[model samples]
Target: MAIGGNPVFRGKNFRSAVATAPPVPQAPYGQNPYGQYGQPAGQSGYGQNPYGQNPYGQPSAQPQGQQMTPEQLDQMYKAPSAGPVETGRMTYDDVIMKTLACLGLVVLGAGVTLFVSPAASLGLMVLGAIGGLILALVNSFKREPSPALILAYAALEGLFLGGLTRIIDAFAPGAGFQAVLGTVVVAGVTLALYKSGKVRATPGLAKFFLIAIVGYLAFSLVNLGLVLFGVVDSPWGMRGIEIMGIPLGVIVGLFAVVLAAIALIFDFNSIEEGVRAGAPRRFAWTAAFGLTVTLVWLYTEILRLIAIFNSND
Candidate 1:
């Protein structure tokens, strides 16, 4: 099975929890495992009477002391297999619920920003951006998922996103809504493709994604430095420069959107693997956090892309 590219899924517990079934015991070749449907081994049974009673299911008259009747055994065989809840394993529903809870907190935090003054909002946004990064790193490296920390990260991210949207939308009206719509569309399409088996997280693709993400991060840090030092007058720094009549930000923003989309795919793959492998139910929070991170990345990239395009006009 493909271990996903998401960092959270690489924990030791996640890896160790997915164990293969043990091999079944085999009887000696060319010997009858069952004989005459319940006759004693020394009489008509072909198999030796080492264990006394037959371990394999042999249809026989129900003895008085037997716990299960033949009809009950038939019902047991016909019953459905245990679900994730019954088996105490992670499931898609668990991921969905946890994801929703995290996102709800994010929305609540964002909504709080609306009532605050611009100055206060800006300060809160900075606090959220710094705090969120810390929590995200802490959660990513932890051996087990921490729901409180994960939700805290989400809430902080919401504040940052809310302030960012307010600032950008002030200049480019309706850009925030457009970015949200674009993110939803992109995510929805990627999920559809994944469900159809047309898209997958392969090892080769994961390697490429890792390299690309590293390069993108390097470029972003360089750009941030340039902007902070006033080496570039434009708000986007080097990204505002034109290349062949197109703003660099537009190009880079699109590339970033693609990367975020791919990250979402990796998140989906990881969650599926965790659930299928019967990971602990609490790990659902980890999956939720991974997904929220990807979605936030996707939303930010889309927002930036829209802002760049609007600025060019």
Candidate 2:
């Protein structure tokens, strides 16, 4: 994620949340840093040949002279062969690979829910939520990452997503497919816009995001209280209430998309940082895990929005 402010916005990887700048490559193994190449035993500099050829300069010797001295030739041969060039740490390619892995887990989990019985599906969902929560907390707090826990989270999340989608699809034809498509379209558009520099979560915007998330959470808590106290009777609880001709769900759904998309930016930022920091190759799974969480949130929000829109139609 991009750093929002010096550290606050950027600290959480606000999508600018955690990506670091480029990384330095580690030196390769077994190569003699002290001796290899044509120079003197302990010679530190690739100093000029008695004739003043440049040291760090690697251009071929000028062919102006008909013959070369043996000393010059040996020095040229001794200079260490240029080490391999290092590309900046992580890249877009890694993101693609990790994204695919995340999607695969999602599919596997979904399968478990769709074909299994209701009792089984319910049990899977419970397990998925609890396991996913535990993994997320562990990864967020641990000094080092645990690959197994991360993967487990993905698998459990898949079950949760699949079961939730199944429940929605039952009441609304093609709801699951629609939500998936909606999620893809939103993700594609967001990525394009971010790459093009058209959409940015600037410092000011991030402050607003924080404020909005807090407000939304407060509203949700209050709404839940109302439902429990018999103050609201709608299926969506407060979300099913209409405000001046507009359903509350639509209003909240739109807001949810913004929040979720920002979360995606945070996910993207983390992936970018992993690559730049040359974070352990295994951390790539953490990148995938973050993305899966955001995408699931985005998909569920879109599904809710569609359902709300259809209510009036």
The CA lDDT at 3 in model 1 is 60
Cα lDDT of model 2 by residue, 1-313, tens digit: 3443112123233233124433453435844343444344565334324444435655536543334556875666556544212332345665578768777887799888988988788888888778777776665555444667766777888888788777777768788888888899888888888778777756676687778888987988998898888887775778887899899889999999978887666555556556655554545555666677678778878987887677656
lDDT of 2 at 24: 51
Query: Lowest summed-lDDT stretch of 10 residues in model 1?
Result: 30-39
Count residue pairs with overlapping backbones in model 1.
Answer: 0
Give per-model TM-scores.
Answer: 0.84, 0.73
Model 1 accuracy (lDDT, Cα): 0.81
lDDT at residue 223 of model 2 (Cα atoms): 80
Which candidate tops TM-score?
1
TM-score of 2: 0.73
> lDDT values of the candidates?
0.81, 0.67
